[model samples]
Target: MTSIDPQAKFRTGAVDMTHGGGGRAMAVLIEDLFHRHLKNTILDQGHDAAVLEMPPGRLVMSTDAHVISPLFFPGGDIGSLSVHGTLNDLAMAGARPVSLTASFILEEGFPLADLERIVISMARAAREAGVPVVSGDTKVVEKGKGDGVFITTTGVGVLPEGVSISPAAAKPGQAVLLSGTIGDHGVAILSKRENLTFETEIQSDSAALHGLVGSMVDAVPGISVLRDPTRGGLATALNEIAHASKVGVMLDEGEIPVRPDVEGVCELLGLDPLYVANEGKLICICEASDADRLLEIMKAHPLGQNAAKIGEIVEDTDCMVVMKTGFGGSRVVDWLSGEQLPRIC
Candidate 1:
C-alpha cells in the first residue's frame, strides 16, 4: 500500500477498499472528511465510543437506520433523515436530545462527492437541533453488495423530572393531536422516483421535532402520549398506541391535515396519505380538557403551525382505530397491510 496525501480533496475521489481497511487511508478519510465536517470536542478525542458527562435527569436513548432511496430529496437526504429520525425518537419519549453517533456504510466506488454532501447535511441538521454528532464509524463494502450509502444514528437525551410520556398512557377521553400535515415526506420521495413525476413538487417534511416536543411538554407536562408517525404514517402510529393503551382511536377525516398536493399525489398513486410515511410530524394524546390549550401551544411553534385535534381515544375491547369520513360515514383505519413505499426512512 502507498501513502496518500492527507490534504488531498476526498470529495473529488471515490471510496476505495483502502478507505475502509483501517489503515492510513481510513485515517485520512476520517480526519479530512468526517472530522472536518462533524468536528466537536468529544469527537475530537477520537475514541471508539464517546464518554458523555450525564446531564441532570433521567437518560433516554434511541437508534435508527436510514436507507432512504434517492439519497437527496426535496427537503432532506439520508444524512439529515438519520439525525432527525433518531432525535425524534428521543423527543417522543419526552427527552431532550444531547448528542448523537452516526455510522456510515459506504459502497465501494461510491462517489465521495455525494458522501461529503451527506456529511455536511448531517452536520447542519445536528447543529441546528443543538445536538452534536460526538462519535461515528465508517465502513466500506463491495460495490454490488451495498447501497450507495447507509447511515445509522444513535441519540441520547435527558428526560425532565415529573414527565412520564408513553404510548400506553393513552386513555379514554383523551384528545388526539397531530403536529402538522401528513404524507409530505412520502410524497416527496415518490416524486423523485425514477419514472414518477407529478404536476406539483412536494418537499419531504423531514425535520427535527425536539423543539416542538419540548414546547408541548413544557406547556402540558401531563401529556399522555407523544409519538412520531414515521414509517407507517399516522394510521399505523395511532394503531400502535391504541393497542398499547388498550383503547380505540376515533379520527375525523376532515380535521386531519393533509396538504392538497400530497392528497392529489396519493389519489393518483392509489395510496392513502394516512398510510404514507412522515419524518417530522408527531401524534399527541392528551386529556380532552387540555386539548384546546395544547393545540394553541403546538400551533405557536413553527413546526405545528397547522396542528389540529384530529381525534380522540375511546374504550374498545378490540382496540380498533376508526375514522369518521367527511361524508358522515365511519370506516376502520387498520394497520398498514403491506409496505406502502419501501426504503423511505
Candidate 2:
C-alpha cells in the first residue's frame, strides 16, 4: 500500500470499480481512510491476518452482518451497530471481548464521505468498548448490485472459568430479567425509514453491553442463560429459551418496561412491542435466589437502569411463554411469525 495525498477528494468523491481493483486506488482507500481511523498496534502490523494472544480461558467468537437500510439512523449507523451487535453476542455467552474484525462491501458509486463517517463511527465504538479492530477486508460491488454498504464484524472473547451461560441452562424456579426498555431501536429505524416524527425524538439504543455483563458475572457467575433480544425481540427470545430448556416462562406484561412513546408508536402502527427489535437490551435467566442481586447489578449499570424482573421459569413439558396481561388476562407470547422490521440491526 502507498500513501495518498491528505486532501484525497473524499468530501465530494464516490467509490468506483478502481477502488477495489487491488491497485493504487484500493491502496489509497485502505491507507487513507480505513487504516487512518481503525489503526492499532495489531492492525498496523499490516499482515494478511491478525496474530492474537488469547487469554487463559475458554474462547468465544461471534459474527454479525449489518445491512440496515438508510445506513444511518437517529442514534446509530451501520458501523456502531455492527460493533455493538457482535460484541453483545459474545457478552451473552459470559465472555470478555478481546478484539473485532470488520469487513465492508461497498457499492460502486457510494459516497466516500458517508463511508468515512461509518468507519469513524466503528472505530469510536470499538475504542469505547475497549476492543480493537485488528484485521479487515474491503470489496466494491457494482452500483446496481448492492446497497450503499454492508458491514460484517466478527468478535473474539474469553470466558472465565466457572462461568457457563446457555439457552438450555434455564431450569424450573429461575427468574427472568430484562436489561431495559424494548422497541426503541426498532421504532427509531422505522421512523427514519418512513419519515415519521413524534413529539420527542426516538433514538436507537445501540450500545455495547459487555461492561454490564462483566459486572453481572463478577457478582453472579452462576447465571443460567443470557440473550440479547435483537431481531425477534423479547417474545421470540423467551420462546427460544423455553424450548431449549424444556421449561415454561410466565411474564408480567406490566413488569416489562416499554417507553410511552414507543408504545404509542406501536399501537398506531398496529405492532406489538414484544415483536419489535432491540439492540441494547438483554434477557437474563438465573436462579431465583440470585435474582435480586442480579437486578441490583444490572440497575446500577448505565445501560441497564430500567432493568426489571419480568417473569420466572416453570416446569412444563410443552415449553411455552405465557404473559399475564395488565388487563387481567393471560396470553401466550409465541415466536414472531414474520419480520416485524427488516434490516433493523
Candidate 3:
C-alpha cells in the first residue's frame, strides 16, 4: 500500500533527480501531490493525455509564459497569473476559454512545498474562470539551469460567429476606450523589487478579463479591435494597431484613467504612466456611433467601472499615435525601448 504521506521526504527537503527518474519517487509525487488538488476524471484517464469534450464554435487559441520575478506578489502570483494571462488573451479575441494545457520547467533544487502551492493556486484560478487545465507536462533542469519555476500555458477557446475583431480593423473616427486605470501592474512589480525606493504598497491589477470581454462582445458585436495592454503598456499596444490598421489617433491625456497614487508613483520614479504595463486592463477601439452603448455596458461591469473614452481615430500620418496633453501640447506616444520591467509577465 502507498504510504499516507507520499511527500514526507520532499516536504522536508529539495527536489532530487530521483523524484523525476520514472521511479517510485515520481509515482508517489504525482499521486500524492498533483492528484490531491487536481482530482478530475480527465486527469484520472492519465494515459499520457487528457480526454476532452470540447464545445462547438470557431476555435481560438492563445499561449503565454509567466516568469515575473518575485513569483508571489500582491493581487496575484505566477500560478494565478499563468491562468489569467492566457485566458485574457483568448477573451480579447472574443473567445470563451474552455480548456488549458500547462507546462512547468522546474529547477532541480526547488522546494516541493512551493511547487504544490503553485499548483493549488493554478487550480483555483482555473475554477474561478470556469476553465480547466486538461493536461500538462513537467521537466526538471539542473539547479542553475532554470529559475525556481517557469510556466508556459496554452489555452483554447471558442468564438461565436459575427464577432470578429482585429488590430487591422481599427478605422478612422472610431472611439477608443480603456477598461480602467493604467500603470497598476508596472508599479506593483517595481514596488516589490529591491533597491527601489517606495513606501506605500501597490498591488498588481493582474486579473483575467474574459468576463468583461464577454459582456462587451455581446453588447457590441461590431467592435473593431481589442488589445490587452501587457508588457509594453497601452501606448505601444495602440501604436501597433495604428500601423496595422493604417490609422491615426488623437488622444486626450486627461481622459485616460490613472489612480492618484499610481500617478504620484510614476512622477516620483520619473516614469511616464502611458509607458507603464497593465495586466488587468484593455483597449477597445470601436465606431463613434457605438461608443455610448459600449460605454454603458462597460460601466455596469465591476472590472470596467472606471472605463473611459480616451481618444478617437483619425486620418493623418498613418501609424502615428498623437496625444493631446492636459497642458495644451501634443506629443506622440511611442513604443518603449529596452526593458523597463524585466521578467514582467
Candidate 4:
C-alpha cells in the first residue's frame, strides 16, 4: 500500500472522495490542513475526543451550521460566520465561550486554495475571540453532490454565578435595547450575490459578541433576555422572545438604527430593513430602571457603539411586536413568513 505524502502541496490539488475514506488520505488532510491551522494543546493530543477541566460554573453550549452562498463577502465569509454564529449563541446565553469544534463537508473537485482560505479565516476569527477550535472532522462528497463547502461549529462556554438570562425572564415594562444597526449583513450578502450590485459595498457586521455580552453581564447582572438577531432578523427575533415571555414589544421606529446605505439597498430591493438579518447586533430586554445604564455599557464597547433603546416590553394578550411608525402609525412586526435571503448564515 502507498502512503499519502504529508508534505504534498495542495495549491493546485482538489479534494477527492478518498480524503473522507478514513485512510491515509483522510489522515493527511486532517494533520496537514486542519491541524496545521487550528492546532492547540488539546487538539495536538490527536485523540478521538478532547478532554478538558470544566470551570466552576454552569455550562452553556450552542451549535450552528454555515451554508451561506458566495463563500466570500465584503466583511466576512462562511468561515468567520461559522465561528461568530456559534460563539454568539453562547454569548446570548451570558456565557464566556471556551472552545469550539468544527466539521467540514467538502465537495470533490472544490479548489483546495479556497478551502484553505476559509480554514484560515475561521482560525483567525476563533483566535480573535479567545476561543480555540479544539477538535474537528472533515469529509469529502461527490463532485456534484455538495455545495463547495459547508461548515458546522459547536461552541461551549461557562456561565458565571448569579447571572441568569433567558427569554422567559422578560417582563412587561422592561426596556429593549439594540446593540447596533440592522440589515448590514443581509444586504452585504445580497450585494455580493452573483450579478447583484450596489453603488457601495455593504460589509457584513459578523463578529463575536461574547466580549460585549460579558461587559453587559458585569454591568447589569439581572438582564432578562439577550438575543442576537441573525437569520430572521430583528422582527422575528423579537417576536420569538415576546411569545416566550408571553409579552408584547412596543418599538419606536425612529429609535431603531439602520444605516442609510443599508436602508437604500433594502428599499431598492423592496425589502424591509426590520426583516433583514444582522450578524453582529443583539437585542437586550431588561428592567426599565436598568435600560439607561445597560445602553451606556453597550455604547462603550466597540461592537456596541451604535447601541440604542429601540422598544419596551408591554402587556398584550396576543404577544405581538408592534412598531410605532415614523409617521405616527403603528404596525405589527410579525415573524418572517419565509426565508428573506436563503443560504444566509
Candidate 5:
C-alpha cells in the first residue's frame, strides 16, 4: 500500500504518467486534490464501487461527457458544467438526483493548479445541488493524444411515484413553455473563444434545474414532457420531442425570450438565436388546461422566473416543428444540419 501525505499541496508541478500509474503519486493526487475537496461519507468509504441506499421509487440514471473548449468560460467552467449538465438530465425526467460519479481523462503535463481549480469547482457545484459524487476513476493520456481534460459524469436519481415525464408523452393541445431566454450559453462561449466583446458580457446560463423541477412536479404531476435545450438548442429539442410524440409544434416567434446582447452577437455572427445553446433553460409540455397553473408554478422558482408560453403541440402525422414569424409568415424550424458552435455544452 502507498502511503499518502494528506498535507501535500499541488500548488505547482504538472500531471505526469506517474499520477495515473496506480502508485504512490496517484494516491497522493487523489488524496490531496480530489478527495480533499469532494470528501463525503459515501465517498470516504474508499471503495471501488459505492454502496448506495436508494429511496423507494424508480431509478433514473443519466451519463454526460463534457468536452467543452476553453475549459473556463464567463459563467462556468468544465467542472461546474459537468455537474449541472448531468443533474439537469435527471431533472428533465422529473427525478430527484441522489448521487453522481465522475470519471476524468487527463492529458500528460496538465497543470496541477488548473486541475485543483476544476476539482474545487466540481465539489462546490455538487454540494450546492445536494448531491454527492460517490465514486470516480481517473486516467492519463499522452500529451498530444488528449485535450487538457475531459470529464464524464454519471448521475443517479429517484423518480417519485405518480410522476412521469418523457419526450414521447407530449400530445395534441399541449402547451409548450420555455424556462428563460435562449442562446446565452452558446454566445457566451463563442465570445470567449473568438475574443469578441459586446456592450454587456454574456454569461453562460449553466445551472442545476433539479430544484425547479421538484417544485413543478409537486405542483403539476401531469406534466407531459420536460427537456433541456443544450447543444442543438430549442429548435433541435422541439423537433426531437415532435418526432418522438408524433405531433406537430406550432411556435410563436415573438413569444420566445432572447437577451438583447445575445441576439446582437448571433446577428453579427450570422447565427440564429433559436439554434443557439442554453444550459439553464428547459422546455415544459403539459395539457393546455394545466398550462396556466404550471406556468405559475414555474415563475415562482428562481430558475424559471422568466418562463413563458412559447408554443403548443398540435396533431400532425408529419411531426414537423413550425414557427410563426413576426411578419405573419410561418417557416419550418428544421433540425440543425451540422454542428453550430462546436464544443458548446
Candidate 6:
C-alpha cells in the first residue's frame, strides 16, 4: 500500500475512484482534503449537501464551470476563476452571494500537487469574496477520460427588497458604465500560450466583483441593469441588453477604455479588443441621473478604478448597437456567431 502522508495530500496524493466511492477513502479525502481547505460551519455539518439559512430577501442563484487551459495564468488560475465566475453571475443579478457549491472532475495520472494549488487559490478567492464553499463533491476519471481537472461552481445570493434589476429594465436615455479596462484577461492568456513578447506585461483581470456590485447598487437604487462583459466582451453584452430592452445603443468609441498593450496585441493579431474576454469587469445600465453616482461608486473601488460612461441608450425602430468611431463614422456591433476566443473562461 502506498503510504498516505495523512496531512491532506494536496500536494502528493493522486485522486482515485475510491475517493469518489462513499467509503472510508471518500470520508478521509473529504475530511483531510476538501474540508481542510474550505472551512466553514455549514460544511462541518458533514452531510452530502450543505443546508444553508437564507437572509430575509429574494433568492438569486447562478452556476458556471471553469475549464481554462494551462490552469495557471498570469494573474490567476483555474481554481480562482471557478469562484469568480459564479460569484460574478450572482452579482450581476444584484444579489449578495452567501455561499457556493463546488464539484470537481479529476483525471488519472495528474499530479496531486497542482490540485492543491488550484484548491488553495479557490479558497483564497472565496474568502476574499466573503463567501464559502459550503458543500462539494469530487470524482476521478481514467487517464485521458478527462482534462486534468474541471470545476463547476454554483452560487446563491439574496437580493434586497425593492432591488429589481434585469436586462428588460434597460430604458432609452439610460447611461452605460464600464467597470474597468478591457481585454487584459484575453491578452494575458494569449501571451502565455503563444509565448508572445510585449513591451509592458499583461495580467488577467480575473477577480470577484461582488463588493463593487454591492456599492453600485447602494449608490443608485433605481439602476436598471448590470451585465459583466466576459466571453463575448462588451459588444455582445451591450447587444444582448439592447435586444432585451428593445432599445438602440450609440457607443462613443473614444470613451471606451482599452489598454495600449491590449490595443497593440489586437492590432498585431487582428482581434477586436471589444470582443475579448474579461473576468473582473461589468457593464451597468441606469437612468441618466444615476449615471454619475453609479460611476462614482464604481470608481471608488479598486476593481473599478478605470470606470467610465461609454454610451447611452436610444430609441430606435431597430435594436442595434452602433458605435461612433473616433474619426467620424458609425458601425453596427453585432453578436459573435462563434467564439472569437475559445476556452477563455
Query: Which regions in candidate 2 have their CA more than 4 angstroms from the true location?
Result: 1-6
lDDT of each: 0.93, 0.94, 0.86, 0.91, 0.94, 0.88
Pairs that clash in candidate 3: none
Per-residue lDDT tens digits for candidate 2, residues 1-345, read: 345454467888899998889898887889889999999999999897999898899999999989999799999999999999999999999999999999999999999999999999999999999999999999999989999999999999999999999999999999999999999999999999999998889999999999999999999999999999999899999999999999999999999999999999999899999999999999999999999999999999999999999999999899999999989999999999966888887
Q: What is the lDDT of residue 176 in candidate 3?
A: 97
Q: Which tens-of-lDDT digit does each residue in 1-345 have in candidate 5?
A: 545333444676788988899998897888778888999999999998999899999999999999999999999999999999999999999999999999999999998888999999999999999999999999999899889999999999999999989999999998999999999999999999999987788999999999999998998988999999998999999999999999999999999999999999999999999899999999999989888988898898998988999999999999999999999999999999988989896
What candidate 5 gets wrong by more than 4 Å, as runs, is 1-9
Provide backbone clash counts, one per model.
0, 0, 0, 0, 0, 0
User: How high is the lDDT of residue 240 in model 2?
Assistant: 94
For model 3, what is the C-alpha lDDT against the true structure?
0.86
Compared with the true structure, what per-residue lDDT tens digits does model 4 show for residues 1-345? 345454455677889899899998788888888899887898898987898777889999999989999899999988899999999999999999999999999999998878888989998999999899998988889988999999999999999999999977789999999999999999999888845676777899999999999999998988999999998899999999999999999999999999999999888899999888899999999999999999999999999999999989999989999999999999999999977899888
TM per prediction: 0.97, 0.98, 0.95, 0.97, 0.97, 0.96
lDDT of 6 by residue, 1-345 (tens): 337676646566677777667788777777776788888999999888789889999999999988888789999999999999999999998999999999999887677778878888999999988999999988888888988899999999999877899988888899999998999998899888888987777999999989998988887867899998989889999988999999999899999999998999989989999899999999999988988888888888999999999999999769999999988998999887786887888
Tens digit per residue, CA lDDT, model 1, 119-155? 9999999999989999999999998999999999999
lDDT at 167, model 4: 79
Q: Residue 122, candidate 6: how far off, in angstroms?
A: 0.5
State each model's C-alpha RMSD to the native.
Answer: 1.4, 1.3, 1.8, 1.4, 1.5, 1.5
Q: How far is 65's C-alpha from truth in model 3 (Å)?
A: 1.2
Pairs in steric clash, model 1: none
TM-score for candidate 3, please give it.
0.95
